[model samples]
Target: MKLLERILKYQIVTSLCVLTLGAVLFYFSVDYLIDREVNKELMRSKAKVSWQLRHINELPVYILQLGDSLQLDQVRYPGQMALVERKLFNEFENEYQPYRQLIFYERVEGAWYRVTISKLLAQRQQLLEAVVMTVTFIVALLLISLLLLNSWLSRRLWRPFYKTLRALDSYQVEKHEVLTFPKQHTVEFEQLNQSVTHFTDRLAATYQNLKEFTENASHEIQTPLAVILSKIEGLFQDESLKESQLVALSEISEAANRLAKLNQALLLLTKIENRQFLAGTEPISLVPIINRKLRDLEDLIEQRGITVKTAIEPTGPVMHPALAEVLVNNLLTNAIRYNVNGGTIDIALNAGKLVVRNTGAPIHIDPELMFERFRKEGTHSASLGLGLALAKTICQVNGQTLTYETDGPWHILTVTW
Candidate 1:
């Protein structure tokens, strides 16, 4: 059976058992109470007869006539009248009361004298029947109420969860739409709805990003490889001039370099997107890291006449030193590559914030567009525009924020923890 039906059945069975036990106990109790009342009335009548016999000296003959009219039998003395017919007698007779036998023989002359008294058992069968009927009616009403209540409660409790399940079932990966869950009043259901919504959204985003990355990587890799193959074929066909062959060989080498860079970019993006950089965290002094990267790029920095400045704090225990290194290297490279002749690159790290500002001509391209892969802002072949994007991905994975803003003659790249 379904869950609701099973719950209803269990509840109904339990309620019925309780009601049945109560009815049985009520039936017995009612029977006992009625029997006691009836016995009291019968004993009262017997007491009146005993009282009349004790005051026999002042009794009239009409008292005997009265006893006949009342269907009561009398004996010679009070003790003799106690046990007349002895019907339905008690197993243990009362010790304080003495019994006497009185026979009600046929009437003689006008006297009509012989006597026998019979005690009747109390009428409890009708009382038991009434109690059963009353309790049955009450139980029926209670069962109806319980069923209605159970149904209402079940619907209210399961409504949100049902909606969540339906949403999940209808989710489409290709569509890439956000799944929304209904709000719930119950705490557990509300929490469940929130968790499901979060999980589905994350899954959809990851799937879409991976799909786009695959498509872009294929296109990027194929174009250059095709150009290189075509150039080599063309060079083989031209056997007339050595200079033409040399130029073709140079073109082929350049194409190969471009292809290699494309592959490396694709691999690096995949690694960042796949969260492969999250190994362990350690204390990394930003000053040393920046100085090392600058030293490595000293030739390029000097050739460009870019004056670099740094102010870093001695912070401990930053997240994922490898990722941090990648982020810093990418930002510094972008700043230096885009800087003007004799430009200035200011790098600062204090507390948990790091800012890399470069003095150059105002960036004509939108800063937002610069973070997209293969989107170069100007005629700079050295920049494939994947560096900033990679840095952004690393920051996102490590729970940091990277933002870009320009002030007057300087473009600022800020990373905050």
Candidate 2:
């Protein structure tokens, strides 16, 4: 979830809970206050009735109405007053409505009289509801306003942080550039910007140093390797060498050759990883590359007496021409090198995908380890096993997928973008 969405979700839930509590409290408070006001009005009606009874020498009947009632009865307790709420059935309305009752005793002409005054509370109840609803509506309106305001403010406040996030997402260590984040007033956002800038600067520096070292080492090692191979070639012309001495020299030559091949493979891998093969700007066809490689290896294919079949549809995938050549060469090399004698090689390309299958013995190694550097099949005894690794690296760098699978007696290597 997005950070702002989570914050908004949490804020809405908390605000609802608070609004519910406040609404309940507001409802009860308005009911209580309205009841107090109603009670005071009822007490004033009682007093006015008492004044009329004392001066006019008759019971006060004007205070009573259709929805209200007053009653006087002789009582033992005097000077006591109380109010209570009750529901009474109205014969005229044919329904029950709430009423407020004021019960009190007063000494009138030396006799104790209990006066009961009851008033219909339907209007007061409506007034209480209106007050509560108005307050709740206002509270809800304020809550909605706060939510909108918070969303707007949060978007504005986090603008700089989001800009920094987008920059970091696209930052590449190989790119020789520094990120320039916008200035932010928030302490946390400023800290994040500083941390990312420092970290990427360090990473770019480290990558540059490592790249220089690999290139230097590869270059330095090549000179010595060439000298050693040349001196060994010179030693081959010495006729005085014994048979055992010749065998020793042959072993040394094989070891040196392997070392040279290993060094070239490592250097190629480093270059692929460093994106050094991105210099070529050409639209290359996989079909042409495949056909050229097949022709180059036609001698070996005929010597092995292998049958080749091709089903190619012309495609133009834009890539570095040299990388494209290396990709096809590695795949074809592995297919030919590891195939059975007089086996079949099938090449298919269409719709931006290429599949090369060769008849070979079932491979027993973990399928996942097949692309690792120095991983080899059991039968390819003289192989260094970096061919498929290099192919996979090239595919990755060029935004393609390389996968290996075993289909019966055929080993299938597929490249797709």
Candidate 3:
């Protein structure tokens, strides 16, 4: 499901479940309350009937002397005849004691007369109607409140996420575009916005670098090819034997070699930039890699009469052996390439910091531009100029920082964790 739809679906289901539970509970509670009130009214009526039956003698005297002359027993009442057919004797019975129904049987001039005194019971149909009405009213009011509350809560909770979703829909990566989401009141949504912003920024940077790399590679390759073609065409124009022509051929060959090297370097940089070298993690030691790279460049260092020093600390372990090797190799190559013929190279490693210093001419290029692709400093312009750039990319992928500085005649490079 789409993210917003999923969120809304869960919210709605939860609200409905809660509302249903509340309604069931309310139904039982109201039923109990109404039942208690009806019972109380019935008890009050029974008490009145009991009081009149306790004074039966006075009741008969009052009933006879009332000027109306029609006695309660002499009249053939509908309810009275029904009670008589049931053989309802006029006597106080234990079964009626609880509800206070009293029946008095008396001999008045040798004729039997029965008097029934009982509280009127409510009809079963009336009780059923009352329960139905009360429950209907309560349920109606509860449902209305539940709907209103559900709407208000759902709108309030999902408002920010909806805005974020809309912003993401309109985002375009090709245009180097991003939509900034507002800070959400909820912690989870705020964290989501931060992660998305970081991802987009990195994507834009990688895309720009790829574009520049393609353009630079095309131009570098074309330049050497054009030179080789022109030299070949000039050689065909005249079958001449001259030292200058031989030198021109050698120069063309060297240019072709340089172009090939540049292509290989560019490919390697692309692979590293895309993080294709990330295999499974393995423990690696930095000292051995650094020492190995320095030894590989020993011949050049000795021929130039440069002094080399090392102060590597024994590290416990590290992940990504190949990455460490690449980083150390690139830094060492750059240091050797840019140093003076009879200068010094100093390498130090201690407390998670690696410092490489070389005695060289002061750099005239911008330090900020030094780590950029195709950027070259003075007198070392023949180099491919991507060694330090590759080193920087390696540091970034491995969660390290590569910084450069100039101290007098020494150029210092530092890598820190």
Best by lDDT: 2
Q: For residues 118-179, what per-residue lDDT tens digits would candidate 3 score against the true structure?
A: 43222333565676676667666766676667667867887887777787787755567656
What is the number of residue pairs that collide in model 1? 2
Q: Which one wins on TM-score?
A: 2
Candidate 3 lDDT (Cα, whole model)? 0.68
Clashing residue pairs for model 1: 104-114, 104-115
Candidate 1 yields a Cα-based lDDT of 0.71
**Residue-wise C-alpha lDDT for candidate 1, range 389-416, written one tens digit per residue:** 8888887777778898889999899988
Candidate 2 weakest ten by summed lDDT: 276-285
**Which ranges in model 1 have alpha carbons more than 4 Å from their true place?**
1-241
User: Which of the predicted structures, 2 or 3, would earn the higher TM-score when compared with the native?
Assistant: 2
Model 3: runs farther than 4 Å from truth? 1-241, 279-283, 316-319
- Point out the higher-scoring one by lDDT: 1 or 2: 2
Model 3 residue 251 CA deviation in Å: 0.8
lDDT of 3 at 269: 75
The CA lDDT at 197 in model 1 is: 76
In candidate 3, position 308 carries an lDDT of 88
